[model samples]
Target: MLPQELDGVTLLVDVPLAGLQAGDVGTIVAITRADDGRLRYTIEIERPEGGTADGQLIDLDASQFGLD
Candidate 1:
């Protein structure tokens, strides 16, 4: 199923993500239907080591992620 807003998910594909892996967990911050009618998600990836909330936000297609 597609992830909803504020849902926790994991990356299923390798991206340009730093300090994170393909299976790294992230939170869905926002969702938007693209011009092609595909649902895109804005995810925030926190440091795996743990520290602050400082992390990178990335936009990915629903197929690139899996529900956590």
Candidate 2:
């Protein structure tokens, strides 16, 4: 079983983004659970200073990001 409420948890992204390389940080916005227990995470990417990145909200696999 996994914690269903993870909206505020920070995410350490390891995927590429708009004008940014992998390893960009993001925040978890939503999550969906598959019947098989795999998680698809909705992440909101942001610029280093502030504001939303062009990448914005995207779905990521569990292997693609880390919890912060």
Candidate 3:
């Protein structure tokens, strides 16, 4: 079972960018439960060049960051 109070919380993280590129700051927009009973999150990474990248969050634990 999952918690009942993670619907609209903000997630802040500094994730690395693939393909040897520099990373950017990201924010979590949404969180939902998948069909397989796993949690999924939608993240938006904002770059310094006035662009952003959309990414997915898989197997992420909020408690690891003391958010629980």
Could you give the candidate ranking by lDDT, starting with the highest? Answer: 1, 2, 3
How many clashes does each candidate structure show, in the order listed? 0, 0, 0
Shift in Å, residue 60, candidate 3? 7.8
Instruction: Kindly list the per-residue Cα lDDT of model 1 for residues 1-68, writing each as its tens digit.
Output: 65788898888988853544588778999998889998889999865687543467888998888988
Residue 43's lDDT within candidate 1 is 94
Candidate 2: list runs displaced more than 4 Å: 1-20, 34-37, 50-55
| lDDT of every predicted structure (CA atoms) | 0.80, 0.62, 0.42
Instruction: Report residue 49 deviation for candidate 3 (angstroms).
Output: 1.7
Question: Which is the better candidate, 1 or 2, if ranked by lDDT?
Answer: 1
- Tens digits of per-residue lDDT for model 2, 1-68: 34233543344444445444466676777889777788877877766676546448777776666666
Q: Which candidate has the highest TM-score of all?
A: 1
Off by over 4 Å in 1: 17-20, 50-54
How does model 3 score by TM-score?
0.42
